[model samples]
Target: MTTTREAPEPVTDVELVVLLDEGGSPIGTAPKADVHTDATPFHLAFSCHLLDDEGRMLVTRRALGKRAWPGVWTNACCGHPAPGEHMETAVQRRVRQELGVDITALELALPDFEYRAVDASGIVEHERCPVYIARVDGELRPDPDETVEWQWVEPERLLAGVRATPWAFSPWLVLQAEQLPLLAGAA
Candidate 1:
C-alpha cells in the first residue's frame, strides 16, 4: 500500500482559490490582492467519477460526521483546493483526505461549471468546481473524520439511493449527475 502526505493548511481567502479553465486545468491562480474575506472566491474542488471494470461507480456515504454533507453519498473522491496548489495537486490531496487512498489516474469530467446555494444549516462558497474521474483498484478506508461509509454501485442504483436519501448528499452532486448522460464513461 502507498501512503500519502498530509494535506496542507487551507487558504481561506477567495484569492487563494486556484483558477482553472473549463477543463479543470490550471489557467492561473488568483492573486492574493483579489482575495475577499467574505467567501472563498475560487472555491476550487475536485470530484472523481470512478467506474470499476463492471461499469459500477464507487460512491461513498460521507461519514455522518462530516461538516458539510455528512452521511451524504458523493462521487468516489472530493475535496477543496489548497493555497498555492494546483488542480492535480488538490485532486490527489483530497482523495487521501476523504478516503485513505491515492488515485492511480484521473481524467477531467465534462461541462465544467459552478454554482451557489445557501441553507439555514450552513453556507457554501463553491462558486467553481473542477470535476475528475479516477480509476483505482485499492482498498478504501474512510477517515472517521471525513466519511462514515462508502460503497460501489451501478449508476442507476446510485440514483435510486439518492432519491431515497435526499439529505445524504450535497445538492450539487445530484444536479451534476443529471447533467451527465447515463452512458457517459470517464477515464
Candidate 2:
C-alpha cells in the first residue's frame, strides 16, 4: 500500500510580519521559531490636515491612475513614514511628494488615533496623524502621479459634496468628517 506525504508548514518574514512574497500566493505562515521573535510592528503611519487662515480645508482628489480608491477625495496631505524616519520629516516629504508644497508649521492633534480601512484597498494607515492648520503661502501644483486635483474647499460645501456623492470618498474619510466642526457650525 502507498501512502501520501504530509505537507510542510508555511513561512513568513519576521521583519515584515507578513507572509513571504511567493510570487502571488498568500499561503505562507510564520515559522514556529520566528513566530515569537518579536519584530517591530508595521502599522504605524502619519498624515497632516493642513488648513488655511480662512479655515478652508486643503482637500485633494486622488489621481485617477491610482490602483486603490482612485479619484477619491481626501484630506490636505497623507503618507507613511519610511523605516527609521521621524514623523516630522515624513510629513514634510509627503507634502512635497503629493502636493508640491511645503508646510512651515504643523499642529499635532491626535498622536495615537488609528482607523483601519474596511477593504483590500492597499491602504492600511495605523497613524498617529498630526492634524495641522497651516496657512497657505505658496503655489499649488498637484502631482499627476499622486493627486489629480486639489483645492481649498469650504467645509460646508465639502460635506454637501460628500452627502451628495458618498462614492467619491474612502470610508475613513467619511468617518473623519464626523469629527469635523464644520457641519454643526454651518447648521
Give candidate 2's TM-score. 0.65
lDDT of 2 by residue, 85-175 (tens): 6768877877888887777766665554556453345444333344444555577666898888888877787777767776677655666
Angstrom error of the Cα, residue 150, model 1: value is: 0.8
lDDT of 1 at 165: 74
User: Where does model 2 exceed 4 Å of error?
Assistant: 1-42, 119-130, 180-187
Q: Which ten residues in a row have the lowest lDDT in candidate 1?
A: 178-187
TM agreement with the true structure for every prediction:
0.69, 0.65
Local distance difference test, per candidate? 0.64, 0.61
For candidate 1, give the lDDT. 0.64
Candidate topping TM-score: 1
